[model samples]
Target: MEFLELPKRTSGNRTYGLTSIIDLGTPTEDLKNILNDYHHIIDTAKIGFGSACVTPNLKKKIDLYKEYHIKPYCGGTLFEKCYYQKKIPEYLTSLRDLGIECIEISNGTLNIPMQERLNIISQIKKDFHVIAEVGSKDSNQEMPISEWKDEMKLLLEAGCDYVITEGRDSGTAGIYEKDGNIRSNLISELIKDIDSKKIIFEAPTPKHQMYFIKEIGANVNLGNVKLTDVLVLEAQRRGLRSETFYLEDRECKLPL
Candidate 1:
């Protein structure tokens, strides 16, 4: 069935316009069913928060995501937990044994200094694809725009494949206001000098998704998405959804 033209999107192992879903303990059978239907559009699946440490059949889930070429990784909070517990080596070994290929290193909750964090990223980069997150999970703690850009630059230079802004799965912190609204000025300022392609904005709501698709174009990398929202998000990205019905034309602006 040939369809009408829609917004162009990179497909099959996409580098841009990535949709990273948060898998917070969906059963293996259920995950298989969902992946069977929507895996092609899912670039990565994050086991939300510290849930990966206790999820039964963890390796099976990781293997399934890998089978579809979707990068599977535990959330950064889990890494913080491991680091605090002085089990960083054990954590990495367990994840490697589980067939995981990518890792997210973040200081969202911990106070790991920039130099130490960089050193950690340097070490981790040798074994896996590293994605560093920059921002505090605390809403009251506002990082200056310059600091955000500076840290992101340093992380990318340290060999992180991408840098993620800390918008928690709830969508009520980090890049967002407490009420779940985006800080448009902050986004504008941060992207003024930094590359949006190297950052994955944690957009977990329909509004967030539409805003990014309209403002940053269809190729914007979005994370912390719910499993149920996958198809609709993809539709929105393609301008098939009414919120972004005109995105095919608007997306030409690119990498703002």
Candidate 2:
């Protein structure tokens, strides 16, 4: 069965080649079905935009994700909401009660001072694994490349387990222009200065995913992938799809 050769991919739980899927009100049954088929390839599942706060079967979903060894966490907006409302202790307790061990800390919508953000990350690291997201959600609020690099470094140094580049669920903000075009120069600068493996780029669209796969190789860490696109993304990573088919050597002959 091991007939075709392809570049090696890190194991699912490993730090590299991570794929973080988004759970935006996916029904429990639908989510279970997806996990039943593709759990092995998914690294994390983010409960999108405070959905976990309102989803009736949040605990059930969290338990299912844990059973499959997938880290489940609330979206950053939920964390921001709790923080601004001065309910962080309650938020952490709720997460614990829900059997969630991971959380995202981001200031994409609310502008928390950088030092304060780092302090929050440090505090959160004590009880939960933190995935610190950098970049603004506002399409017009472009940040200088230096600031991006610095913030990423600071988050990592502040004890964040991973750093996520801001690509809103729509894939039209943060690293992408309003038209969904990537800021290639900014990304290039970040890659040049930071460890690509330590950062996850949110690529919600096929075009964005293809660009990252081709530009950063098949093992790039990607996030915000839709549940339906999980298998498709895996195909692209293995060069089974047209966009990456050239990654394999066509000239090689298989044994008859």
Candidate 3:
């Protein structure tokens, strides 16, 4: 079968349909070089794992990413830890000073109640384009698929720009099995009535990315992706790689 035609999203300076890269402490200069080389290919850049708090030159780094037209967001875990320690308002203020226009709101590490989570979503969007996460960091802590669906419905309705499923940085927690594979039964359930376009699946591992593509197709929204993999990830998204090569090869086997 020939490849399916996927709709193209607006590139650069886009509000939605974005492909983001997680910069998990890539050295400042190297990050600049990557952005200089591939800025057109990256829609968003994240200073990963709260590494920002100690990165020393965050303001300069943010300035560089901004120069390349990449919007940077704070890593959610850092935000949550500060919030739990009663420093959320301070954290937001600091992020603003650093020129962050996007903020990720997630309770992946801290156990924030529903009402409070929704409030955080509402409050953040009032000042920034909020990206909310819907799962937990602990692998043993499983939320019913129903809860995830409800959260997605509410987060988008609550004025969040996107709802990211908490696939964690490893992609082996939450909905994924220990082998880093997506549990189809669970995924199907979560997306039953949800819009895939508004979701950002945390498929950090390549196998998880492959599974999502093979099972859900190219348009699935992915997040927490490593910076070095941005080109390859986009290649996989555009079906320019061998993962789609066999599908290309199959044309020769078909009857004319």
lDDT (C-alpha, whole model) for all candidates:
0.89, 0.87, 0.76
Best by lDDT: 1
In each prediction, how many residue pairs overlap at the backbone (N, C-alpha, C within less than 3 A)? 0, 0, 0
Q: Write the per-residue lDDT of candidate 3 for residues 44-143, one digit (tens) a residue.
A: 7778767888886889889888898888888888888888789988998898899899888888888888788888877777789888888888888878
Candidate 3 segments whose C-alpha is farther than 4 A from its true place: 1-10, 15-17, 246-256
How should the candidates be ordered by lDDT, best one leading? Answer: 1, 2, 3
Candidates 1 and 2 compared by TM-score, better number:
1
| lDDT (Cα, tens digit) per residue for candidate 1, span 137-202 | 999988998899999999999999999999999888889999999998999898788888888999
Instruction: Tell me the TM-score of each prediction against the true structure.
Output: 0.97, 0.95, 0.88
Better of 1 and 3 by lDDT: 1
Model 3, residue 41: displacement in angstroms?
1.6
What are the per-model C-alpha RMSD values against the true structure?
A: 1.5, 4.0, 4.9
